[model samples]
Target: MGISQSTLFRELRRNSSPAGKYIWFKAHDKAMERRKRSTGNATLAPN
Candidate 1:
């Protein structure tokens, strides 16, 4: 909710269903999947 409106719009557009409906569970899953894929190296690297 602290995100900018444009960012919120972009995320909804990216993760929403085919019907253009936003689902929390589906969106969260999609975000987690993307993070998992994109953070592979980051997760392995030492902080």
Candidate 2:
């Protein structure tokens, strides 16, 4: 069976907030940088 819209919303609400504010922002920035590096093929190119 498929998940209901309300259930999905509730799940998103549950995990969206982080307890540590600094850690949350730091993690978000790190994740974005990691995505950019991976998608830009930085590892494949020579330094």
Best by lDDT: 1
Question: By TM-score, who's the top model here?
Answer: 1
> Taking the tens digit of each residue's C-alpha lDDT, what string does model 2 give over 1-47?
39999986655554455752344566567667877878563466678
* Candidate 2: residue pairs that collide: none
Question: Roughly what TM-score does model 2 have, to 2 decimal places?
Answer: 0.35
Worst 10 residues of 2 by lDDT: 14-23
Clashes of each: 0, 0
What is the per-residue lDDT of model 1 for residues 1-47, given as tens digits with 9 covering 90 to 100?
79899998898899999999999999999988988888465455678
> Candidate 1: deviation at residue 16, Å?
0.5
lDDT of each: 0.89, 0.61
**Against the true structure, what is each candidate's TM-score?**
0.66, 0.35
